[model samples]
Target: MLALNWHRPLMLLAVAMAILTLAAIGGMTIDDRTLTGLPIWTKAVKFALSVVIYSVTWAWLIAQFTRWHRIAWWAGTVAAAGLGLELTVIVIQIVRGTTSHFNFTTPLNSALWETMGLSIIVVWLATLVASLVLLRNPTSDPARNAAIRYGAGLSLVGAALGLLMVLPTQSQRDTGSAVRGAHTVGLPDGGPGLPILGWSTSGGDLRIPHFIGMHAAQLLPFVVIALELSARRIAATRPVAVRTALVKTAAAVYTAVLIVLTWQALRGQSLMHPDRLTLSAAGLVAAAATGAVIIIVRRRPPVDPATIQPTRTAPGAIR
Candidate 1:
């Protein structure tokens, strides 16, 4: 793990990110409506939060994949570039009136930011899955290989998408009056062109589908983390009793957090249509029911205890 130990900077970066994120949260202007997109603030916090996601995830990915530092570096770079490009899409749309400013209530611009953000999350998930697949050797062991591959692969994919970019505004502009975008700017006089650089966030709401997807990364990653933990505990167990207990414990926590995230999605809706408690309450109930179903379906199926070989064994033995 010498190759990995050489990444104190990455850990430091994560810590710094946490600090900045907290600071941003603390500094927000406290009108509940403001956060939910009711009013436009001088600096938009939600979009800023997306940047924090990229930064924090990028840092963690690098630290985890230190053994493959070079590859991790490349992926992180790409992911960051992707985030930047997404940001540019947001800014351009906001500044030039091609789309709505990251607000969910309206479907003005293409949901490119939310789309790429989720894509990055997917890349991270892919790394985790790929790592698990790679680490299945007797000598190196599946567990070990998985950890290394995920850490490195996530960081690398993150980097590539970072540098490569697509312009969303240019997209809507080409279509002209067909798009009424989040930016609130639209076709000329009656049809063919947008009011160049037009920007407005008046009455923005969170009821839209794109924002709901944005919150899933927050929920899904944690779910994956919980599942992986449950899996590891199962593999480490030599007996059914121990595996059963750990898996249950992990599932309980995972289910709870998943519900919490679903509720969060509703919070966006609340912002969009003020005083619509019926809609919001309905959402809460739905999110809870869905989370429950997911947890129930994810329970560990009965398996023979003998099937799982120990994670570590003699040199030639399966691990």
Candidate 2:
């Protein structure tokens, strides 16, 4: 197990999120109010949980930097503060019994929404700065290095996807409603959705790809860790070169999947009801990833038996 020099500010932010998560969970039990067809506290709980994961992952990631540590630390701190403010606005809106996002019904609501938008932009920019720093300083372990670099790049892409949700839909424009935008592409915001996630089941939901993309940073690192652990029993995965190749392959597939999900959402297709084209595209990506993994495993160098030492007989009994 490697020792991690965790960033204090980011870890504190994560702790705050954990506390908020518990508060939101408790609110859900007592509060019966609904927003956009779901429990009012649902958004709070989800955002809190997401922030906890994001903060913890970034805390660990920023801690790994030896060069440009100050720059990385500042970036992480800015990101933590921005995310904290964003979540704070969500909780405030929940208390106010109104939505926090894309809301322009009143001056106060519009200002709150604008604050969130600005905070998100700040967070994204801060993440970009840290990512550039990571790129400049690579770790010695090839697999871990690939995970950090690719994960940061993909996470930025995912965070950018949120911008799409701020654009007013055609209906909103035609109706001239105070509400400026929505999460659903083809339909209104309140509609049939998944259980806890509340992702649209009737229309396209941009949040799906956005959620997947943002977590890539954590997920990719987890992939490298899993491969490293498997190295104990799987000889083919033990080689640094092999593990690096596999990580690259996994990152490629992950990117392809994100693209597919984005394309599907843009087409106003529900995740629960994927069209043939979406299915085909997903299948193609899966096939490519499978083939790549097979080739990588097969190309592994054969272990030399000459290097294996023979077991010596105990004392003089066996001899």
Candidate 3:
């Protein structure tokens, strides 16, 4: 049974949206008039599902960080309201037979767009604040600490990419199209794309990096947990320091990958159409990441087991 808390409302909202998404999928077939030439409400459904997972995961994770219940409550509240409003607007616009994002069709639409954008910013700022708080109050477990730091930092990068997405693309400015702002890079909006993701298969798409970076909050911690379990399985006497170093190394490599993806998109290259130069650059990034990891691991001195505390089992805490 799920506990009743600030996060619970958001989870319920997510459930509702999920049901609506299924309904949309079942009721609405392909609509050529929509943005992506798919169902008009597809993006809203995707955003709903993403937020559902994000809200629940964030709430659970934050609870494990600090025992300050007030801060956790407020963070969860802001996340719920902000994401809820954003999704509401998107769904409303879809029902009205229009695009939700980058829509300045009328004064009302522009106002709605601005409201949605501001709401997103508010959520991002709240998340940033909470992440900083977690950093300031470090966890006893070094492995978890590394995960929290890396997750928070990468999550910020992801939010910043949201800012990038909102800005008017150079192509949009050049063409002076009615929709003067779009998420796509090399290709125009609603162009050839992959199924479901709608990522431009023919050219660059900013959403790729945005998606990858945003989920780092969830991914980094999962990696830490896995590392911890693996270490225990090997019956390593002292694993905290080693795990911390490994997490840092992984974070560095993850950031490098995000950078490479961003660079690739900015160059108007499709993800699948990477040139020789792109491949070479990626290879260099990987090599550098590996070298850094090797150096860190070598430098990591063996920690005395006597100095370390037995790992505690907190709710949602990394084992």
Candidate 4:
């Protein structure tokens, strides 16, 4: 059984964020407005959900990679503190009825915003370090190893996206804005956006890749686990190898999709409108992924019935 004793504090923080998320949902009913033209509670809800997901995932991963117990402790502590401060500042701004990100009107507001930015960088670095540690000390199973490697690598991409968000964009340069760059492309920030996510459908939005890449930590492991469970049903000697190939193939496809979305966004194209380049990239990704899967499955070892577990339950079986 996977144990979470290594990062108990972060797990508890995740529970707290879950509670805050419910409260944010309730707050949404109040209809308070924010500078982003969205309800103030929307920020809270997003941050709360993100914190919950990240905290839980990190806790579970740290538990699994128990070799670096001390490193895990420091990483978890930094993550909890950094994320907690970020949410606190966001919620505080919400309460004050002001903007949180890129706000530089007043010195105090600018200071808070800068602090939030620093916190994000700190947390990102912590996550990167943790991922590197995991990569250095991987599990014996090939499929599981693939998950750790790809998940950590993709997550670094996600973290790097944040750094990009801070850089001044062409729009900001053209306008000579005092503050830093914004996340929205081809349109001003806080304009009409998609429901819930608020991603700009009118133009390129960087948040899409950030969201997808950030969740790779959860998604990659999930696929590997599902495949492992499925593999247990058969008695193939090369189950591990087969699953490893599939995992690599899946990671490749996932990276391709991320690159496509990012390229489209940079081009100021809407997610609904993919040009020839985007389509061609996606087609190639699909073809390559499919070919990899087919080759791995075809080359899988013969299933030996003798090694397969009996379907019938034993007398002392808990079931």
Model number with the top lDDT: 2
Between candidates 1 and 4, the TM-score winner: 4
Q: Write the per-residue lDDT of candidate 4 for residues 29-124, one digit (tens) a residue.
A: 876565676777888898899889889878877777757767867888898889999999998988888888877768888899999999998998
Query: Against the true structure, what is every candidate's RMSD?
Result: 12.6, 4.9, 8.2, 7.3
Please give the distance, in angstroms, between residue 307's alpha carbon in candidate 2 and its true position after superposition.
10
Write the residue-wise lDDT of candidate 1 on 1-319 in tens digits: 3432433433343344455445445544443332212332223345556556545644554555435556655555554554455545544443443333333334444465466456556545544443343343222233333333333333333333332222233445566534323322221111221122112222222222233333432443453355456665545343333333433433344434334433433343222233455466556656765675455445555687999887666797864
**Candidates sorted on TM-score, descending:** 2, 4, 3, 1
Worst 10 residues of 2 by lDDT: 1-10
Q: Is candidate 2 or candidate 4 better by lDDT?
A: 2
Give the range where candidate 4 is weakest over 10 consecutive residues by summed lDDT. Answer: 1-10
From the highest lDDT down, the ranking of the candidates is 2, 4, 3, 1
Q: Give lDDT for model 4.
A: 0.81
Screening candidate 3 with a backbone cut-off below 3 angstroms (N, C-alpha, C), the clashing residue pairs are none
* lDDT of candidate 3 over 154-228, digit per residue (tens): 978977887777878776777765565666786677888887788887888888899899888889998788886
Of the candidates shown, which would achieve the greatest TM-score relative to the real structure?
2
Report how far off residue 207 is in candidate 4 (Å). 0.3
